[model samples]
Target: MSWKTFPKVELHLHHEGAAPPAFIRGLAKEKSVNISGVFAEDGSYVFTDFVHFLSVYEAATQVLKTPEDYHRLTLAVLEQSAANGVVYSETFLSPDFCGNRDLSAWREFLHAIREAADQAERDMGITLRGIVTCVRHFGPDKAKQTARCAAETAGDWITGFGMGGDEGQGRQGDFAYAFDMAREAGLRLTTHAGEWGGPQSVHDALDDLRVERIGHGVRAIEDPALIERLVAENIVLEVCPGSNVALGLYPDVASHPIARLRDAGVKVTVSTDDPPFFHSTMTQEYEQLEQAFGWDEEDFAALNRSAIDAAFCTEDTRARIIKRLESQ
Candidate 1:
């Protein structure tokens, strides 16, 4: 009944956010960066709410000042994910954090991350892909620069573009120009919506940015019509129940709407968004879902199929991930 070895696919994860506290502490010590405010005495990340979590998250990222940091980070994250049964993972990477939107510098960071990804794939059997992301709180103009970075890097490794950060800062439509650039460059699109911003945020993301998937679209469960639309359009949701609970979107896993959304025929996939921050793993997510919704291995298998179908990887990579899921 253990889910630790079950093959899984993750569609939503933040690269810097996935760094383990111990790793961050070690990196901070090595760099002599004063990021003590970001962690508790026990060494876990300490934040009171979502906005505060963002601040703490950014604080932790201070130690990751170069491409080499990201390279090591990619390996650390992938090793943890692989141990937790994640076979395929798509991580959100921000050019702002990588190189302050400088194209050449972003490429260097991308290359370093990709090298680590290749190593992880070879050693850990976990396929890693990047989704270049624009921080919504950084505003639309900055988003344009981030999009330009994404457009330039659209390829087999960096296959998707998305918006993450404070969804409450601006409407999804505000970043239309940025999303358009990424779309025209052949990068698939997704955006954070409906977690704190509510059902209308999901509506705006679909009607404006036209993303194929939504990060934390659980609030769509509040509106029957939205749920119906998601089903009709086959829009996928990258649901992170543990993250939601950790951030007080829901009191606990049982109160989360992922089950309700899935039962409504919505294409829902599970992920541990900033796993260590949420004190979760792919295994923990499965265990919580199984306990809350009574989801069995069959349910999880179907979820993996849906995730693979919605993944932004190339068809060959998708097929390979599907095989891994089936082999279980």
Candidate 2:
């Protein structure tokens, strides 16, 4: 069977990062934002390295100046994801982008996004959930505010809290207060680790933040004890093979440690962390994994189940997703 024909689940996507280049270009035209260099002649985002990638990301975000922009982005992104055979996804949303750390504006953005999400579920049969994430590189004070917004807006759609940014910025412990606040509000937690940093970063994220999942945790392969602990604790790794390869984390797809980590008894799920930035989609991720590791239908199905199990959605939603996976 073609990998594109396999139904899948994505648990490590980012809201703004998923915006298509055409969409951002149209928005730029509307707002008269000077972001031409950010895209290529064929209308795709262009960046050389991780730091420049962040700049391009923020440049694309400049056009998303209102709640309605985000609402439209949510619908557009989901439509594309559904076309790529993704049946369930959880995307990271930043309060800093939604409202610049204002709770009221954040609520408005959340409402718009949730409304679009409900419509997407009805029209495309795709389940969408939000994980309120703090930009770790922005500073701990901002993260606390982001956590406060997430804590205040705890509901069916906003189900989780996370940290995403330059992992090398501040120590993981510096953000413990924010995670604690979100935990108090009963939000499931995760953090980006082991992507740009080494195994010690993963250790700090687990020991300090106490996350239930690790985003791009392929680096944990460096520490046998850490891999054993992840298996023992049953923590899920939202592995994004395409992102790792694009960012030089791995020299090539053949060298990726995803299959090895799974072989070591660690639970793993696949996702496209930033689809357009990495020139990847859900279908592409599955296809590359198949080509590199000879992943078959059963492997894809089990990966879907792992995503559903690690998802931060409500139990009822999870049950429905599991039922869909079984039917697939």
Candidate 3:
């Protein structure tokens, strides 16, 4: 049951959302900022509902105001992930929080993060790629700026662009231009859908944004036709069962649809969306899947294979990760 040594790939983590509560609290204390309401006395993020969760999540980011802070955060998060057997991960990075949507400043912050990632890979043996993301409720105009920042940095490190926020905000179609901009700049696309919105949200992401992947697309299980389309198109769902259950999308992992989606031939991959917020780690995710559905090492390997294939990383990096997974 100790899944910590099992090699894994994660494709849907949030940068700021992944910050450990103690890290943020330290920053807050250093800056003389009193944000006691954001955390429980036990040192975990505290929120009662999804909307409040987003609010608390954003509040925690307030303490991460500079590139150095993010650098330190990158190191801490990567160390934790490495401890959980993540060999490679693609995290959702938002320029909105990195530098308030400023391209020049975003680059500075990115440099710090990449440097930290380089060190983490050397020390912890975990590689990281970023997916520059736009906050949905922040609206389309700001999304354009976020897209521009992503476009300017689309390369080996920042390999993709996506959206994450309240899916109930403006229609996915409203953000097509932003996604288009990122796509034209050679960034693979994805977005948060079917987490708050229904099956139609997943359809809209495919139809409007033309994303190759869906963040939390498990809700598509509600529409068998949409599920078929996902399987037929081979679109990957960045399923975060822990996050979903923590946010009440499902009451518990036992009731989550990841197993159903996999059985239905959907190319589903596992990830801890915002691990600290959900009180999970890659090891815990695997353990829960095993307990809930009788999954084992072979099942995890297949999931990792699906995630690597769907990942936005280069073929060379993919090959290296595959080699590691095989050797494990």
Runs in model 2 deviating more than 4 A are: none
Model 1: per-residue Cα lDDT at residue 18: 97
Ordered by lDDT, highest first, the candidates read 1, 3, 2
**CA RMSD of each candidate after superposition:** 0.6, 0.8, 0.7
The TM-scores of all predictions, comma-separated, are: 0.99, 0.99, 0.99
Cα-based lDDT for every prediction: 0.95, 0.92, 0.94
For lDDT, candidate 1 versus 2, the one ahead is: 1
Question: Candidate 1's residue-wise lDDT over 1-328, tens digit each?
Answer: 9999999999999999999999999999999989978988888999999999999999999999999999999999999999999999999999999999999999999999999999999999999999999999999999999999999999998999999999779789999999999999999999999999999999999999999999999999999999999999999999999999999988989999898888889999999999999999999999999999999999999999999999999999998889889999
- The superposed Cα distance between candidate 1 and the true structure at residue 182, in angstroms, equals 0.3
Off by over 4 Å in 3: none
lDDT (10s digit) by residue, model 3, range 1-328: 5799899999999988889888898899899987878988888999999899999998888888899999999998999999999999999989999999999999999999999999999999999999999999999999999999999999988999999998778999999999999999999999989988999999999999999999999889899999899989989999999999999889999999999999999999999999999999999999999999999889999999999999999999999999999998
